[model samples]
Target: MSSLRQALSGAGAVLLAVHPTLAQTAETSAPTNASAPPPLLWFLISMLVLVLLVFWLILVALLAWMRPQLRQIYDLPTVHDTWSGRVLGLLVGDARLVKGEVRDELLDHDYDGIHEFDNDLPPWWKYGFVLTAIFAGCYLTYYHVLQNGQLQGAEYAAEMQQAALMVSTTSDDPNQLTTYTALTAPAELSSGKSLFATNCAPCHGANAEGKVGPNLTDEFWLHGGEVNHVYKTIKFGVNGKGMVAWKGKLSGKQILQVSSYILSLQGTKPANAKPPQGEKEAPAKTLAAR
Candidate 1:
C-alpha cells in the first residue's frame, strides 16, 4: 500500500509538472482566433483536465480504502496549533521529526568516519526539485530541439519585421507630403543637393549617371518622371523593389528638396551614364512649379 501511494504521488507530481508546460506551449504555438479558442489548445486543455480528474478520483478511492487503518491511529491531532503550522503540514505532509528529536534507529552505518540520518525528504523541497528538473527539460527541448523559443537572433529579427511593418503602415497617411512641386529657392536647392549627395549618391551615382538605381540625368523614368510621381515614389517606395520608403527615415520637406535636386539633374548628361530603363517622359512641364 505504501509503495502504491508513493507511485501514485510520483505520477501526480509528473502530471502537475507536464500539465502547465504543455498548456503554455500550445497557447504560444496555436494560431489566434477572435471567434473561439484555437482547436489544438482546446484539445490539449481538455485532455489535461480529464487526466487530472482521473488522478483525483484515484486519490479519493485510495483514501477511502485506507479509512479502516486510519481509525486505528489514536495519536492524530484534532487541529493544527497555528495557521502557519497547518500550511506547513499541507506542503510537507507527515514527514517531520517526532518531538523535535532524532531516533537512534534512524541513524545510518558510518562510512569512512562519516555518518548520515535516514530522514525523509520534505514534500515541498522534493516537489520543487522535481518541478525545476521538469522546467529545465522543457526549456532545453523548446529552444534547442523545436527552436520555438525566442533566442537573441529570433527576437532581433521579429523586432526588425515589426519596425518595417510600422513604417509601411504609417507612410500611407494623407497628411504626409506626397507631392513635389519643384523648389526654385536657392537655399532649398542647396539643401536638396546636400541631402541627395548623402542619401541617393550610393545607388543613383554621384553624378546621377545611375549605378544600381535608374539614371536621374536621363529623361526616361521607371514609375513616371512627373514631379509629383517622383515625390510619391520617394515617400512611399516602389513595392517588391530595392527602394525603401524614406518617410520613416527622412522628413517630408527633406524628400521634397531631394526630389528638386534630382529634377535639376535631368537633361544634363553625366559621365559614364547607364542606358535608360523605362519610356521617356514628355519633358516635365517647366522646372519652376508643377
Candidate 2:
C-alpha cells in the first residue's frame, strides 16, 4: 500500500511539473496558427483527387451492373427477328437485321445463266426519300399553290421601286442649283464637325488640310467654291475621281451642314497642307455673311 501511494505521488509530481510547459507551448503556437492562412493549392488538389476517385468508382459500378445486358447484346443474332430488334436495325441501317429473312429466291429473269435477286431499298434510304418528298410538297404549297411568298423577280422589282422613290426625293439634276446659304448656327456646325471627323478625316485629314483629298483651308476649289456648289459636289461626288456619292448615305440637310462646316474652315491654314490641285477661286463672301 505504501509503495502504491509513493508511485501515485511521483506520477502526480511529474504531471504537475510538465503541465505548465505544455500550456506555454500551446499558447505560443496558437497565435501562429490563427495568423497564418491555410494553403489553398494542396486543398484543391486533394479535392480533385477525391472527385476523380468517386467518378471512377461510379463508372466501375455502372459497368458491373450492365454486364449481363452487354453480354446479351454481343450474343444477339445478325438477322434479328424481333420487332424491337428490327426497329433498332432500321435506325442503324443494318441490312440483314432490317430485312429479317434472307431472299434466296432468285428472280424469274435470267440472262446467260446469271440471275439477279430482287432486293428492296434499305429502310434508312426509304425513310430519307419520303422525308424529301414531304419537304417538296410543303415548299410547293407555300410558294406556288397559295402564292404566300414572292418570287425572285417580284422581290427584285419591289427593291427597285423603293430605290426610285429615294432618288425622286433628292433631285440629281446638275442644272438645278441650290440657293442655300452657309449655316452659321453653332449646333449645325458642331454636328458637321463630328460628321467630317468620322467620314472625311481619313482622306481630307483631321483639320481638312488634305491628304488624299483637296485642302479646304486654301482659296482653291475642286468642284466649286460657293456653298451651294459645295453642297452639290458633296451630294453627287465626282464619279471618276475617288469621291464616293453621299446621296444615298447622307440626307440633304446633313450634306448642307457638312458643306457649311467646310466653308467655315476657309483661311485657317494648317501645318503640312497639301499644294493646291484645282483652280484658285475667290471665297463666297456673300454666303459667309449670312
What's the TM for model 1? 0.40
Model-by-model lDDT, in order?
Answer: 0.76, 0.81
TM-score of 2: 0.40
- Model 2, 6-92: lDDT tens digits are 999999999999999999999999988886556566788899999999999998798678766654663488535566666545434
Error of 1 at 87 (Å): 73
The weakest ten consecutive residues by lDDT in model 1 span 93-102
Tell me the alpha-carbon RMSD of every candidate: 26.7, 17.6
Candidate number achieving the greatest lDDT relative to the actual structure? 2
Task: Look at candidate 1 and tell me the lDDT of residue 219.
Answer: 81
TM-score of each: 0.40, 0.40
For model 2, the stretches where C-alpha displacement exceeds 4 angstroms are 1-170, 285-290
Q: On residues 174-285, what C-alpha lDDT tens digit does candidate 1 reach at each position?
A: 3343444787789998998998889899999998899999898888899777777788888888778798788788898998888887887878899999999998877764
Measured with C-alpha atoms, the lDDT of residue 28 in candidate 2 is 100
